[model samples]
Target: MPDHPDTVLTPSASAAGVAITPTSASARPRGRRRRRPLTRAGSLGLNVLSAVAGILIWWTLAKVGFNLPTPAAVAKQAGHLLADGTLEQDAMASLRRVLIGFCLGCAVAVPVGFLMGWYPVARALIEPWVQFFRTIPPLALIPLAVVLFGIDETPKIIVIFLAAFLACVIAAFQGVVSIDRTLINAARVLGAGDLTIFRRVVIPASMPYILVGMRIGLGSSWATVVAAELIAAQEGLGHRMQSAELYYDLPTIFVGIITIGILGLLMDRVLLMAERRLTVWQERR
Candidate 1:
């Protein structure tokens, strides 16, 4: 009998089914090469097909006189916005604010998160404040923000900060608290101090979780940007869309929606790539 599935035995009739040679057997790459894997083009085409189906449904509803515009009209409007440069300006303005606020949010959240996780006293003191803020929607603070900071970039950026900060804090805190105690014990057994244990074991173990939290926070920040800009803003994709709505320009509205979607997709992919590169050890896991 073979010791493992990978080992094969050649049974000889002369020996009445006695095992002859239990040798390791290797399969050829022909198995993989024979399978016709789906190409990138095929995957893209499927996505395009789905989009066309959605547009067709939208067009049908529009022709039957629903509120939405047809696909062609929206495409034409997108082209016009591209040529006029309004789209570029507004999108950039919104992106700049989100980036600035996201940076501030992560900077504050990470340290606080670490503190809350590492120290019980800090957790008891800080967790309540985090919970209180997290419960409040980013939009609810708009009026207070406007009153406090006025209708300027400051207020808008503050809104973004609120959205991003609350997200990251909780994530980092949870990551640290959830670390395996066994790892800590192992490090201590090896003569590591508290600082060494935290620095070498706890931080690395918690990083994957902390990074995931930031990714979520980034999305929240972007979503909150438009809401932040919606209130008394001079320029931004959200502001532009709101302004278009006032004029009842459906095509312009479509362009704003699509622009936001595309930009969000791009940013998310960049974050995902960064996370993948930084956490390659997790992959080999």
Candidate 2:
């Protein structure tokens, strides 16, 4: 043992017949270091590389006798669509429906979800209907929607709304339900009221879940809007694709598919950015 209790006899020190004083040990650098995240330039380069690789693979598949249209053909079709303003009009139509439906659904869902999760009485009253509707696929409701609301924008928007609502509501409910009970108790012990605790603790804790749900709901909205458009009326990517399918226009179909994917990916990225901004206080890997 060292004469001074503050001296630590570490393994390396013992082997070298030296004592590591507390001050020296404290002054030593830590072994483990944090890894640096990718720089924006590096991340951008990687994304570009990935996209190029995907295109190369797609090109190879097209050359290998796949029925898929080549990238060039799809681009040509896209150019034609753009030249005539078909793509813009269709994209705007779809975007309008998705935005309106998704926004309204999320607006309603978050409060309802909070109520369901926070109040037992509310849960008892609301959960059964939520679950029942959730089980019935939004696509399956097309006939009912058409019959009730007619084959106009109303039914299409309603279907998209249902899709978004179900996804977000479940996410929000789970977020609230999954909050740490200890946090609430600690807040109470700190003389915090229910409203204060909820505002400070519950909402922050539940935000990640709510954001994840919103992302999912957004995807659901897009998917439902496309399918709704396919079954219903005119101007939209889904309608364009359905028309192309009848004529076996592979390039047009590919163009629609790519357009939808790109739009969805862009929207999801926006949501992801929002989530990161909102959850800055939350720890991440």
The best candidate in terms of TM-score: 2
TM-scores vs. true structure, each candidate: 0.81, 0.87
Question: Candidate 2's residue-wise lDDT over 1-285, tens digit each?
Answer: 667656666798889977466655566689978899999899999999999999999999999999888999999999999999999999889999999999999999999999999999999999999999999999999889999999889999898899999999999999999998999889999999989987999889999999999999988998999999899878899999999999999999989888988899999999889888989999987
**Ten contiguous residues minimizing lDDT sum, candidate 1:** 21-30
Please report the candidate that would top lDDT against the real structure: 2
| Count of residue pairs whose backbone atoms collide, per candidate | 0, 0
Off by over 4 Å in 1: 1-49, 283-285
Tens-digit lDDT track of model 1 for 166-207: 988898898898999898889989999988987888778778
The CA-based lDDT of model 2 is what?
0.91
Where does candidate 2 stray beyond 4 Å? 1-36
